[model samples]
Target: MLILTHTLHLNRPSGKVPIEIRLYQPLPTGASWICNFEIDWPEVRLARHGVGEDALQALVIALQVIGAQIYTSPYHEDGSLRAYDREDGYGFPVPSNLRDLLIGVDKMSF
Candidate 1:
């Protein structure tokens, strides 16, 4: 099942590109909760997996991994154009954004 889906608008010289991220739950036969994720780029689609104890944990790991990929990518540099996370209503500040998303989780019993 698809757990989460978000679109990020990345700035390009020619125009803005829409990058979609989709996260899915682990398969029944999997040993652990494998968070499968896909990044739909303009020209290509990338897939990867993250292992966690639960669905929420898996999702967090997947997002952090993808965020690092974006931070080091050539698409982001010192430019007027910036990438925006439409769902979160914020720019690509990487770990900060990820941290903000997990604000309340830190205090949770889990």
Candidate 2:
């Protein structure tokens, strides 16, 4: 089992804020891998589960779901929140190691 914890910064026009997200395979409470998320905006706190052959695969699935939600968020549609784009000058940089890990995974379903 592997545990990954990362802080996502939402670069909203108002300012940047951090959201805490964690993924753990074979969750401490159950048999499945779980993604736990907390966001200050709209005050959301929830967890979701995914299935995969290994911890990294499971982590990718969880990330896909989380990312989907982010895309669908109001922030995305309004252009208030933007991802790391060099020209746009928005969003924060993801840690190097984490960026490499995410880049290694091909986009997949949850």
Candidate 3:
């Protein structure tokens, strides 16, 4: 159970504020996600502000895309909301299954 963490920073060419996204897999969720399949993907996205169902669905989609065992987190009230950073910027632990979505997962200093 390696904790693969990454970050999401979606930027708009129009200069609009970028939408931060955080997505991970191997979630501790006891749902049927485990019996799905093996995930080789490496990128994830979160709701950040009000992505709503899209964000949540995106998580499940990402996981199901490759097939990962969702790890449940007692501290994770709403994993999607974790994308946006209230103080500075949004931050989320990158998941190996969704790391491909990240612009620069390896360059991430944090």
TM-score on alpha carbons, each prediction: 0.62, 0.50, 0.20
Order of quality (lDDT): 1, 2, 3
Clashes of 1: 0
Candidate 2 off by > 4 Å: 11-14, 26-41, 83-110
For TM-score, the strongest prediction is 1
Candidate achieving higher lDDT, 1 or 3? 1
lDDT of 3 at 13: 48
Question: Model 3 — TM-score against the truth?
Answer: 0.20
| Regions of candidate 1 where Cα sits further than 4 Å from its true position | 27-30, 78-110
- What does the lDDT come to for candidate 2? 0.48
Tens-digit lDDT track of model 2 for 32-84: 54444333444676566655555555556666655555545676556554334
lDDT of 1 by residue, 1-110 (tens): 89778776767678777878787876533655767888786678989976677766666677666665555545533332233433223222234544433212221311
Give me the overall lDDT of model 3.
0.32
| Model 3 Cα lDDT, one tens digit per residue, 1-110 | 33334433233345323332233443333333321122221243322211113435545455333211222321122233122344322233344654443332222622
Please give the TM-score that candidate 2 achieves against the real structure: 0.50
Question: Ten-residue segment with the worst summed lDDT in candidate 1?
Answer: 101-110
Q: Which stretches of candidate 3 lie over 4 Å from their true place?
A: 1-14, 34-60, 63-110
Descending-TM-score candidate ranking: 1, 2, 3
